[model samples]
Target: MPSTEITDDTFIRRYADDIAYVAQQPPATDLATLAAQLDTVAPRYEAAGITGHEDLETASLHLDEALRATGTDRDAFLRRAHNLLRPLVADMTQEYRLAAGD
Candidate 1:
């Protein structure tokens, strides 16, 4: 699978925002929505057995870089981090379901 190409400043910032947003909420439909979105970008991660934790670690690196570059606000950054993480969790959940033939 091709590597995720989330290098643009705007994309990174938005992704970071999404990650942060999801982190604040309890598990809900929004988390599912974010996962569906991420499936469009890095489905291979799920296919290749990467779990939510792995995805979070990867996203954290990117988010950290973006925060440093933009000096994002704390609340905004936390929300973004949550948003980014929700999808990874969702993706892994789906992966497990699919693997188990759900």
Candidate 2:
């Protein structure tokens, strides 16, 4: 079966739990997963006319590098990923709320 197109709302729904988990307590595995997830949806975000698509793409790239460098400090990588993703998630959440008239 073909997958449905990714919309901002759908993206949020897909990642909300993961986002929350990362926000509260991010592990290396979860950060990797979130990075992969972000990379997957970056093109969708651009196609959906979302702002900050470039920033998301850039962040995802950084995360990819972070994941690759095994000797790097895990805590530092987590912080970097968290900092990069936090505002993106906030913007997406606000966009969703406004679209839904909440």
Name the top lDDT candidate: 2
51-85 in candidate 2: lDDT tens per residue? 76666667667666666665545434444655566
Model 1 worst lDDT run, 10 consecutive residues: 20-29
Candidate 2 positional error at 31, Å: 2.5
For model 1, the superposed segments whose C-alpha errors exceed 4 Å read 1-48, 51-54, 58-72, 100-102
Candidate 2 Cα deviation (angstroms), residue 87:
1.7
Q: Model 2: clashing residue pairs?
A: none
